[model samples]
Target: MGRSTLRFRRPAVTTRRLIRGLLAFAILAALGWNSVLLAAGNSMQGAKKEEGGFEGEAPTAILIEATSGAVLFEKNADELRAPSSMMKLMTAEVVFHAIKQGDIKLTDEYHVSENAWRRGGAPSGTSTMFAAIHSKVPVDDLLHGAIIQSGNDACIVLAEAMAGNERAFAEMMTKRAREIGLTRSTFANSNGLPDPGNKMTVRELAMLARHIIQTYPEFYKLFGEKEFTWNKIRQPNRNPLLNSLEGADGLKTGYTKEGGYGMVGSAVQNGVRLIVAVNGLEDPEDRANEAKKMLEWGFRNFEVRTVFAENETIGYAKVFGGNTGSVALASHEPVKVMVQKNGNDKLIARVVYNGPVRAPFEAGQKVGVVKVWRGANVAVETPVYAMDSVDRGSTLRRAFDGVTELAIALFRAGVAKL
Candidate 1:
């Protein structure tokens, strides 16, 4: 219900340059403050290239710190475009989830139907594992083929075995995508061949890649394999990052006449992992080069800094009719962000919740989130919870609080009219 700005005083910085840069900042007020606000800046789409910021060649791209899911840089990251082969990441996630849930096993074998073979196999004139028609292949081999070789046939066979057909499987992919926080991505086929319905933003793709890396570490290593051999035929991994970037690991790549070139990539350096996604590039070399550049730049420029410790009271949310007027909020996990090591960058951290919440809530109940921004992009966000239980307040206290809220609402309305 209230917002305030906190600025960091850069040591020995020139005032003229500081004024021109106008970077945002966040500083927690003294403990027991009821309300505080953090500044908001331009969205990534509108943020201009600063003096030291990385400018990527891809039209849509994002770079983030994997541990904290912090946005280091982004450019048109939410604009949806044909995902091409990058949609395979969704397909892989579904299979991994099914396996984890015991609905399927790696040893399970799926039939290579004529439809799968003819459309996505050797005869399809597309990327294929040369899966023979009527062959029964185990899920393990299929995953290897799909991931290491970008085999369309392998994806179709798994799709048919799992959900009766690729269409139904695509629906499952979209559903699972939403469950994992990929809200804007949609799927039309198992292998991401070409469909108007298959679209994703680079931001979601990066998030998906991070999810796979973190949730299914054992399965994710398949993406980094240099080669996969099946039916006596061998093919190399399609992701260029593994070969080009040091410490680069698993992920996927895509290209189409309509979608251009795209890829999702990750790497670890100094124990810090970073995820990068790029799309809408005109050339394959540009796609590879741009992704590589972004990853290297992130590793070189950014470092994680703890903003708030675990169980540290971050701020308070107003409570209606509780034992007290407000509830203290804190995250079970330490709050962290990725910032430039130079300490020249500014950030904004805010406690966001809809309240004064009507209480009688238990301690540790999730109430809201702490969102921290670096420039215009959200650097990190983590959920905050009630630090202690709040029982119903006395009747007189409730009535007084209600009257106070009513007065505040009326004042806000009058101000709006003015």
Candidate 2:
């Protein structure tokens, strides 16, 4: 199932200023910042929201933690639909990954073919880089053709140039998509030109964008360049949100009669990167504005505040059958909350698990659940794992229980030998 966004729109200055003032007073008073922030406000402007599924109703929309692949929001994230030019992200990503792996070169040139030049309007049609047959253009130009201009001909040329043929390269693409954990995508062509079996979900596209950006930082500049020129032809980027959305960087745009307007866009604001993908849009500009609105709403509303550090003792867990009476409970990672900038303290944290816990636990094994709450509802529930191993009681001697353990161990050892 997909999930709804904890999304809301509000002017940010008021909450920010309030948080700032509270921080200053806390510093001067030498008191806790979290305590002060919690004590001060009672506003919903910064309150936690209810999360719900977005997968069933919409075709596919997903907002993800660009770096972590942690799904922040989603709508039918697994459904396959026309990827539009968003397919070019994969095309570009494949080429770049190849370059990074030394499979091709920056200056390598390819001869354009007639089939590439022949792709024109719908029924397996769309834009062109105006690339002509027999023209020996560099891989760099073909890159622009496939990406900036959304050129089908350029895509085919690059595919053929990198591999012996486009079909081979597309197979490589699907293989790579699976390797990158993209379960909801399949590629039938190098270009995003609508094909009978070609489709991707919004989650897959965003995942591709995040991976390409993070995994190939050295090559990301290509997507940000506003325009490119080759063989006396000029091509501008297709993503309209590049300049229209403040802090917007690079992403791809797509449109086929069936896919409508689609975009995979990201922006960096106050050091946080937010990526949003929307398909089934009615028009190009409509998708662009929706992207901007969603991004602005996200950036404006949230700011992270730490409540506890990893290994910081949250409380003590009472062990049921262990040498120690209690184990120090803590978060495995920093416990932080995304609260409205200046909003009041509606956030609460509670740790729950099976009482204390039985022994035989290992370090980092989850033993309890941490539910972050806002007022009456839970905001997020994450597991709190054992910070260190809690060995099982050694005094007990069992025949059947020990045999079960021995069998499991022997089975694993045999599998390892095989």
Q: Pick the candidate with the highest TM-score.
A: 1
lDDT of 1 by residue, 231-275 (tens): 889889988888889999979999988899999999999989999
lDDT of 1: 0.85
Candidate 1 TM-score, true structure as reference: 0.86
The 10-residue segment with the lowest total lDDT in model 1 = 23-32
lDDT accuracy of residue 137 in candidate 1: 96
User: What lDDT does each candidate get?
Assistant: 0.85, 0.69
How many angstroms is residue 199 displaced in model 1 relative to the true structure, after the best TM-score fit?
Answer: 1.4
lDDT of 2 at 108: 93
| Model 1 RMSD vs true structure | 10.2
